[model samples]
Target: MASSIHDLARHLNISIGTVSRALNGRADVNADTRQRVLE
Candidate 1:
């Protein structure tokens, strides 16, 4: 089953805002972190 941002964030042990930013490709997010999110 697919997970939502909240679930993903919890799984990754990161903040929901971080997940949102990473998924959105926001410049504020770290490149490595963004790549992890994309994958």
Candidate 2:
């Protein structure tokens, strides 16, 4: 399992900020992208 936001982001091929925003439920992140992060 991913140990940190950086790991998750790297695994998902997205930026750390994107993973953080998605996890935080920020509106700026696309719903599909957020769903990917959530999964």
Candidate 3:
């Protein structure tokens, strides 16, 4: 099953907001961190 954003965040050990921001391509997230999430 595909994971929801909340599940993904929990699994990744990061905040839900960070996952959301990274997925949305927001500028506030660090580039490396965003890349790690996407991978």
- Specify the highest-lDDT model's number: 2
Colliding pairs, model 1:
none
Candidate 1 segments exceeding 4 Å error? none
Q: Residues 1-39, candidate 3: write the lDDT tens digits.
A: 988999989888999999999999999999988987898
Tell me the lDDT of candidate 2.
Answer: 0.93
Q: lDDT (0-100) at residue 10 of candidate 3?
A: 88
Backbone clashes counted, model 2: 0
Q: List the global CA lDDT of all models.
A: 0.89, 0.93, 0.91
TM-score of 3: 0.83
Candidate 2 runs further than 4 Å off: none
As a whole number from 0 to 100, the lDDT of residue 18 in candidate 1 is: 99
**Who is ahead in TM-score, 1 or 2?**
2
Cα deviation of 20, candidate 3, in Å: 0.3
Which 10 consecutive residues of model 1 have the lowest summed lDDT? 30-39
